[model samples]
Target: MFHTAICDLLGIRYPIIQGAMQDAGGPRLVAAVSEAGGLGVLPTFGGTEAALRADIEKTSKLTRRPFAVNITPIGRAFTESRAAICIEMGVKIVTTGRGDPGLSIVEKMKAAGIVVIPVVPSVAHAIRVEQEGADAIVASGSEAGGHVGRVSTMPLVPQVVDAVKVPVVAAGGIGDGRGFLAALALGACGIQLGTRFIAAQESEASDWVKQRIIAARETDTIVSSLMTGKPVRALSSRILSAYEAERARCSDEQERAAARGRFLSELRDAARDDRTYAAGEISGMIRGIAPVRDLIEAIINDAAALAEKLHALAGRS
Candidate 1:
């Protein structure tokens, strides 16, 4: 079996981590990943303290294996509270993104014997978190779904690996065994996959959402700030298309303001008419939905076989 720092640190058999997606990383998905020998992270965004605790309890009841919980620390008011709750619940890992959770939160998690993995968008941020005692860094690139950084995974992984002492987990545009092997070649110890897991049968996403992902092309995802106040990558749905069309036609401030109102209205109820299947460019590579265990095993086994073949070819040369 393959092993890395992430596997050792997180106490998992595989170094694969299911990237924490808001609303998608619920108890069902989280428990399945952990049971399948990978780390599953429960996302704590857009939920209350009581709700978050209940989700944690549910995941804990489902699996005894180690799992993580993610918190967005940039603008969220209850970041510290969430961290405290994770620690209190004996979560094995805590992943922070968007921005650093400051030294206090990092130190607290570290002191509580929890590994801290921070998702970063740049080499600078990776180094900063490593210095702040982050056990590992997730080098999330622009190709990822939802909020992403400017760098692509191809360049960002190696850059972050070279700059930081901690283990780096590559994120973005990774779907199958080829992508897993590529990340290892780029000097990453592990991988955090968001889009790939969205199509998994265990995911909380609706069938319509999963079908939309399965039907999407490489160019179907667009990054826009219209959905949320901040820029996020989402499927190019009818709602997003309508919003863009209206904005282009608006010539004056009065028309622009009217378009903005209509845009927000459509975005709020997008699921009814135009579902926003927030996903990454890797959606193009996904073919079918399978159980989390089967998917993870397939990726690991395929990558292993490819590595063996490469080694044999290199020896002959």
Candidate 2:
């Protein structure tokens, strides 16, 4: 009953897709999400070709459901190898982030009967991907984790939907069924959740990371370039505070350069004590960790109920 274009394309029961998080979306989490009827995307960041291949094989053993492999387009040296492995493994979808997946890469994936979904931050990029033969587009907003854009989900989803012919998936600031209903109302075919899934029991995130996200308030997150080289929304931590202090005190380019180096060094050494937790603004809504199956079922059930309530309201009006 809740089927959408994304569900049909990805072959999932619900339109919820787990966002690919570096070092967290391992085989267990990937398989669990797919098993629970949501699309799971495996992260290939900082992984070798053999490691990625083994992980894919492991996930395949865990669940017969379809899943996707995420490739960051930074290092072209290994991207092709990873793509080749994905094709060989019969992966149905490939999700690219950080940059455009060039025509060559897109053609390679399409020639293998794979769908290409690129994470786009703007309408221009969304249109470009559609023109480049992309099967779908994830319009990630500034409220998302890792890297973020300048727009919010409320506006970005509708704009991208209007600009592109392929299905649009909404990312950022989505936590519950109400958010799901809102995304559908905004013309998104599905919702991509990162922060909520990070707190799931199947997630590979450290216990401390999950605890931090559970304890976080809506205002606890800040979008800053201090975390990675890009603008990301993450929890306020000592690392972020120190970076902001240094950036504030720097008067010239040399001072800024020194501050950047120092901050990055500290970031590298940050352990559980000073580690920054990347999460969406919806962190406040997540109360505890549950298994992927329970989590997805509850979200879909809640969304269904909410949709019925809205329909009743409209009938009375």
Candidate 3:
């Protein structure tokens, strides 16, 4: 019941894509998602080429199913280098985020017969990637955990679908079967989930971060650039709030850079037990940790049931 064009496009049993979360995604999580029939993606935002190669090999050994590598274009060299590794390692699918992964990189992947999917924040970005030969697009919104744009998913997905010829996947503000079905209704071929997966038992996120997600509310998250010098949405904490306040008070670039460094340090040390991490608005919906397979199955089963209920309602009208 959950099968769609995305499933065919990505060679998966279900039309679901696990977001390549930098902190929570690893070989274990990626393999588990792929084993459960969704396209699990490994993050390479701040990772090295050696790390990416090892992760691909490890995930391959863990599961025979398909998975992907995400190249967050933090720099031109980083993006191009990671793409080369993916090609060298024979990785079949690649996802890109943060910004354009560059036309040259996308073309290289296509030339190698690897599928390229780019996560975009707007219709304009979606159109550009399509022209650059993207096989699919993930329309992530500001409500997402990591680097995000100003728009939310609801309005962003359909506009991108209308603007681009490629398949569109919806991300941000999604955590369950309800959101899964909603994305399909909004013209998405599938759904990509990040924050929800962070609470998975296979996730690499720390206990503190997982517990924070379980206990969080809708308003508990804030989007700040302190972590990566780019807007990232995460659960708010004393350190994050304090940094935001300091950022407001900084009189010069030097002071702001110092403040940013301090915030990152607190995060690195897990100091004060108050360091926060990326989490989407969906944090409020997560209540506990479960196996990655169980989580993916629940989304598919629940979405199928929900679709039937909606069908019955529609027939009545």
Q: What is the C-alpha lDDT of each candidate?
A: 0.88, 0.88, 0.91
Model 3: how far residue 169 lies from native, Å: 0.4
Candidate 3 least-lDDT 10 residues: 267-276
lDDT of 3 by residue, 1-317 (tens): 67788899889998989999987999999999999899999999878888898899999999999999999998888998999999999999999998898888889999999999999999999988999999999999889998899999999999999998888999999988999999999999999999999999999998888998999999999988888888889888887888889899999999999999988887788764677688999999999999988998899889989999999999999
Q: Mind giving the per-residue lDDT tens digits that candidate 2 earns over 1-317? A: 68999999988999999988886789999999999999999988778888898899999999999999998876666778888888898999999987876889889999999999999889998999899999999999888887888888999999999998899999999988888989999999999999999999999999988988899888888776775567778888878877877788889878877888888888888786687767888988889999989988888899999999999999999
lDDT of 1 by residue, 109-173 (tens): 89999899999999989988999999899999999998888899999999999998888999999
**TM-score, one value per model:** 0.93, 0.95, 0.95
In the order shown, the candidates' Cα RMSDs to the true structure are 2.4, 1.5, 1.6
Candidate 1: Cα lDDT at 63: 96
| Residue pairs clashing, model 1 | none
**Candidate 3: stretches off by over 4 Å:** 250-255, 265-272
The predicted structure with the larger TM-score, 1 or 3, is 3
